[model samples]
Target: MHLTLALASAALIATINANPSYYVKPIEDENDYARVLELSLLFYEAQRSGKLPQNNRIPWRGDSALDDRGLNGEDLSGGYYDAGDFVKFGFTMASATTLLAWGAISWPEAYIAAGQLDELRKAIKWATDYFIKCHVSEYVFYGQVGEFFLDHTFWGRPEELNTTRPAYKIDPEHPGSDLAGETAAALAATSIVFRNHDPEYSDKCLKHAKELYKFANRYRGLYNEAIPGAALYYESTDYGDELAWAALWLFKATNNTMYFEEAEHHYQHFHLKERPNEFFYNKKVAGVQMLLAQITGQLEYQKAARAFCDFSVRQQKRTPKGLLYIDKFGTLCHAANVAFVCLQAADSHGIGDPQEYRQFAEQQIHYMLGGSGRSYVIGWGRNPPKQPHHVASSCPDRPAPCGWSELDKNAPNPQILYGALVSGPDEADKFHDRREDYVYTEVTVEYNGGFTSALAGLLQLRVKSIT
Candidate 1:
């Protein structure tokens, strides 16, 4: 078994190096984490929607989804595709933005050292700019723009999309507290990210954040109900977590006591102290606890953070190779999410034996890089995924025009989806690079959010001072 694994690893490494289109050399050290951080930024660029700027790094991706607009023809043409599919889900997109912004704010040195600080800001700006458009009115916010059933039927490049994409929104009557709250968090967090570089933009983000937070608290309901189609994919379970999460971010951005008090109120009223199993686009109890610990230095929040990380490191089920196996789908995404949350917990307080948590994070991240004997990230490391279930990258470049035939083809994707993290292995850590097998091959914005955040955290630890 060892011999076979060795041979397979060799073959995968050869394939990766031979593919120049996908190759992105490391800065100075060949430590895979630094490259991982760089490629994760590429993934976000790959997922970009709307106008492709002159500085666009993705050659295959052009200006697509230009006509995406709000109900009143309000331009909402920026942001990103939610996942492998071509839908712009506000809830997931906002959650991803918040995670990315949090990482940038937490570890600016990591990005600067990696020379990804500029790219990172551009990534967050794309989403926030679109969000600024989505907030067409004080009360109303466009939640989604594409229909899933219709979207799933057509499998081609987003640039060639030829169908009606009716927009949906949430107003006073159809209030989506979860959606509003999460967006508020995203904007508030981004406000901090841009505070030094562009104070005006920062102020704008904070204004929207404060208004959205007010909207969320004033009228409460599940976001899926406001936009019924969202129930098919991203049906929110509870708004309590987002309410608290948004308040916490606002407090961090503004250092205002009212927001902190609101954060505490939401924390207790929503019972957010209960340690959550995972920290993805949906659940955020673990993140809340960690952030609370950082902001307040209260033993209560610190203890909760420690409990969550301790459970993850000691009690969580793992594959034979020590990869935390939380769920069947996006297994690595889940593990990375926990790793990032735990890293935050360890960083914020003297909780849970910081060294142990750090080691655990490194182990989990390494498993994603190559410890599993195969890289789960597209276009990097040994035998990385060559055929991720993403439409844009799956499509052949330029005038070739992709369709259902592209989906049916038995070959690696024509274009390399650099840095995109795909749907990971099953229970036993088994993964295949097949475009049709979305369960094991799909990529998403949320998948990269936590993974990249963890990478930045690890990079910060290793390369403390960048010359």
Candidate 2:
């Protein structure tokens, strides 16, 4: 039976090779540019309508936005409270990158998308101004800088003395304390956005991006120390998951030999001795590995990507009531991660044997929508189950008792229901199901408008590539 299954898998893979959409290519043409732009637009529209949740907010115990616990202050909570805000920034960069590439290949489409040149000029100006204002020091921390303490106490409030004091002290070096891989990714995405549309902002974007790249490079050697190898940290001071996303984006934008080389090194080292089944516990990292593989086009990377996807598919949860449930792992999900993987695969290998992937993505979409396009809040896990944690618990020689566990058995399922879908057409076709899965009472608004503006250029590039 195992041999037969292996043979069947081989045949399915062969079918993928037969399809044209499966092979991955750099965004070198109009069609590719269009696809990315379309996806970006869909994501943006979703955010505008509040179809995606913005659970990254701190709720006040009373009616006032401010509370005694630093939770009311801006700096107390980290910056991760707004899902829409993060997506806006991320998609903006993505769109801009696509447009820039499109312009290089098809100037006419790029020109038209630039709104006959003059409007494009205004857009560029606005983007430059926006980015300038958005620049918060040299780094972005996880929570609000100088806002509130973890327990919701004001930075300087003295509970015993009943006196108002300085909330907290900022680290000059780590001013924006939560400087992490995701923040770097946001910066990199924005840099590409500016570089494509607003030449004026390009220098600023590049400067910050290079700094982030350098920061990441400083820890390249430590990647192997973590599971899935080369995962980026949530901050410079700590490691979380093996996140290679920033590296992938950096390589895509710069095509710099060093970035690509580092990316390759990290990729190989992470997957060299890893098995397909080992990834079941951490699909987000696994999904990222698939994306890098598709982006780079190494056969080994492709194998790892395929194996991880297969593993994820096998591990998907099916509710007794007939609904499919994707296990949530710390603000993560099966739909978003799986869709990302499938899209990358389809873009890399074409569309062969993609039915499973497509079906799974669609199912996830349906689960999110609660049976229709009606919006609903989805919780972390309805049927919460204990799963392995992906974060490392200790070092190789001296393992820390309270450090990140290799597989966190007690970690909250990171299921994020809002603005998580990063790719695909923006249609309700069977995928949009509006059901009450979870609820988040508070919401926050954070915009990466500069990046979104940059995406206009990418759309133009997509049109040019196809024509």
Candidate 3:
């Protein structure tokens, strides 16, 4: 038995080393640079042809479908339709900024995607302006700065809109009384952009960034004097998954040991408790943990990252028809979180059994593109053949199931999209057999961004290694 086990381990290592799919390249290098340039031309052409507009307001009408699969098949008629509000806070717009930032760092080729340096500058300006519009001066503040409202607590309160009155009073019990996470996310985005393009905005961005850090520290830290033992209430605590992302970005931009120390401190205090099994559902938290682990190279962080990848692999749902479903806790398999975790594992740890993670990612893409086609809206929902509960509202009557589709319709499906590299068994069956029906569904654009950004970061590292 020992001999057989040793042989199996050797075979697994060989497989991992032999397969490049087990390790995905980050979009940061020369190859990605060329791709970004090509994409930029396409974007420019789309703009000239009235497909994409000059402003950040997404051109949703007249071939405005961003999903290529949907557009190609002419199935882009149904699903949600609105002006490209990609500039709004607490939405995929905020996350896209992080993607752009990662692209700027790792895939500098993305800078050329604007077709020229001047165009690139315009793109940055547009993104920054949009971010600025999303800021809230105080809780319940009202303004038409962006497509989405900036008032109300993260938990869904205020119950009123368009009024100038403070929607919800600031209180310790309700640290999320305003867009705390979104605020932090905005600051991070603004900081990154300023760091690269506009030096003039650096001081302002830093000030806001520090304010965000201070807020998170004040209410979310375990040893915090202002709010002792308050870290347990993640729901209302000022810090959560998004704050962690902000910390990493801040550290990267500022290179401040304090920010790194603070980020590490939070990861140790708040995230490590759940440990390996923690990532089964919360992709945002999982993504944040992965980034922290990678940047710090802490053993505990690595262990957590491995645990998350393992849990994700184990949780894949296998359909009776022999299809593998890489969905999260609730919805039809989405690619964002799954892709991010798998890619990170493959890139960081080499995913010993390369085929397992690779095949799973591939199967998820197939199901998403083939089964759902362009209608592959990822959020939180149960596997097919299971009833989906109403978990959309903040105060839902009952808890919702785990999964990306059920979380928030507006956010990007990070469970599948970001770090996608298909390879593994068609495991769509396991989702149907799960006995636990109650699931908590909370999906925010902030978390989705962190998840994808972390995956991008991992890919960058892997690509650097291979090159």
- Each candidate: RMSD: 5.5, 17.0, 15.1
TM-score of candidate 1 to 2 decimals: 0.93
How do the candidates rank by TM-score, highest first?
1, 3, 2
lDDT, candidate 3, equals 0.38
Q: What is the lDDT of residue 130 in candidate 2?
A: 30
* lDDT accuracy of residue 412 in candidate 3: 23
Q: Clashing pairs in model 1? A: none
lDDT of 3 by residue, 206-288 (tens): 66656645654454432122222222212222245656666777787778888777666666665643543333222246656
Note the clash tally of each candidate: 0, 69, 58
TM-score of each: 0.93, 0.46, 0.50
Model 2 lowest lDDT segment of ten: 56-65
Number of the top lDDT candidate: 1
Q: All models: lDDT?
A: 0.85, 0.33, 0.38
Question: For candidate 2, what is the lDDT?
Answer: 0.33
lDDT of 3 at 99: 47
What is the descending lDDT order? 1, 3, 2
